[model samples]
Target: MNLFVEGFAWIFDPANYSGGQGWIVRLLEQLAYTFGATAIALLIAVPLGYLVGHTGRGRDLAVSFSGGFRALPSLGVLILLGLGLGIGFKAPLLTFVIIAIPPILAGAYAGFEAVDRKTIDAARAVGMTEWQVVTRVEIPLGLPLLIGGIRSSLLQVVATATLAAYVSGGALGVFIFDAFATRNYPEALGASILVTALALVLEGIFALLQKLVVPRGVVAKELKDVRQRSSRPLAAAGVPAQEGK
Candidate 1:
């Protein structure tokens, strides 16, 4: 359609890439906000999540807290922080940190919980110290889920960082908001397209990361389990089941 062409043309325009407030600068600013927030959130969430998961203590409380935290509106939080702290990068950073925490926390603890009890016990039986078991066995086995949590948190932060422009913190959202105020539909659409493309690219990168980090044996076993589960119903119904890859 004409709108899509106009939007794409606006995005690819050479003029938009030259200024300090250009697309590249805004894109980098957005990425900085997202990555910074994610790192901070991970530091705070991962240790607490691991402790709760490892000890099976305070898990319910942590889960409840994460649920409550996730329900808090990012925009509202940003607004309140801006009001109290007087709008700047600090408010947006804090807002992003808050938004990024819950998923990472939930993922880390859930990863810990998902590790097989038998495997953990076997590690203990093999004269592994508690620390050794956690470091060598648990963390490796739980890595997929941990990475999954990080991915979720990263995606959320990236998406929400767009709101940074609302608080005068630089981000790609400036294009969208500024365009709307000026009735520049092409620019607004272009910004949105860039945001979506960025998110998808990030997602693909993380997906590749997940694949690389998860153990090969674990991947094989999971695949086998899926195949077996799928065959069960067919067996009961006296029908041949298609083979799984």
Candidate 2:
């Protein structure tokens, strides 16, 4: 379409790259919101997730809560918060964090559940303290799943951060909003393209992270048997598995 062509053209325009609100500036602001929200969510979710996973209590409750949390529309929450709190980073950051919690929570509990019970019993049989077993055996084996949750959370947070422009300003979403408000279709398309590309870049980064955390050899072994396991966590959780690896 003409809009796509024109949008690409607009993206490369040298004049658009120099201002304080330029692409790089906007991109950085989005990243800041993303990291801030995710960091906060990690603090809240990781411990809760780990506890629920390690103790095996309240998993049903956690799953139910996460499902509900995921249903909260980020932009809607941002608007409501923005109206009440006024234009500021607080509202947007809180909104992003709210949307970031679910996947991380899911990943945490699921990671623990993904581990073979026999492995855990074996560790306990060897006279390892509960803390030692958790730290030495379960945590390492479950880490990939926990990181997978973070990866999913980051993806959600980054995408939601774009809506930050709706409540405040300084993110790439600002361009799209400004362009549409003035009927600048090409610029709007360009801004949307930029946002999509940013998400893709981040997705690739996390994908590499998932791969790096687990050993390739172990991952290779699990990859062959993933289909055979009924309760196996998704590969997005990471590669090296505990069953045999």
Candidate 3:
């Protein structure tokens, strides 16, 4: 309790708000690192993932790569890269990009896979070109899952960006690591709180984005499922089910 109180107090203190080393500045740096990494990862992963999902070629390879990438340890990779590249933005950026790729890739391919085969067949039957089918049918229907992947990747990137400080890339982790080294518990805790808060904020924002981007039919189907699930309990208890007019 005292630790949390002290941490919150430290965060709100006016003295901590000004310098280049300020929490706000560190937060912005962290956001830049996270966003930059995610954008690059999306550019690389999404297109390939979509291509694999659309063509059904190279899928096994993509799946293998996604699994392999996820199994890697971000910290170990960062350290190895730093040793090889010798401590610069390159190491941290590579580390962040590597960590962010798998989920986005998986999401893109899996999203397409999740679309009904019949729907895809129908699109083809309608004389749509392969490109048109992918863009018009698969992409729209698979959007929810695609965004889900982006959400997962974004969250992972945000959390992993803290490792940037290890390479002197400058982020909120600096506060935590620096304070901890000096035994400044309040500052360390405060930095931790800020990181957690930032992650949550990003999560909420992405969740809203996911909701907004999902196709209307998908949203309707989800709502219908929710309604049915809610009515199941009433049916189990022998209550009369209400019918929609």
Question: Best-fitting candidate, measured by TM-score?
Answer: 1
lDDT (Cα, tens digit) per residue for candidate 2, span 158-243: 88787788877568888888997999998888888988998999999999999899656437745887667643474547754567
TM-score per candidate, in order? 0.91, 0.89, 0.88
Error of 1 at 238 (Å): 14
Give per-residue CA lDDT, model 3, range 10-115, as digits (tens). Answer: 8999788568989999999889988999999999998989998988888899889888877788899998998888876889888888888888889999888888
lDDT of 3 at 207: 95
Best by lDDT: 1
> Which runs of model 3 end up more than 4 angstroms from their true locations?
223-245
lDDT of 1 by residue, 23-133 (tens): 989999999998999999999999988988899999999889988887788999998998888877999999999998888988888888888899999999999999998
lDDT of each: 0.89, 0.84, 0.88
Q: TM-score for candidate 3, please give it.
A: 0.88
Candidate 2 segments whose C-alpha is farther than 4 A from its true place: 215-221, 229-245
* True-structure RMSD, every candidate: 4.2, 6.8, 4.8
109, model 2: CA deviation in Å?
1.5
Q: What's the lDDT of the predicted structure labeled candidate 1?
A: 0.89
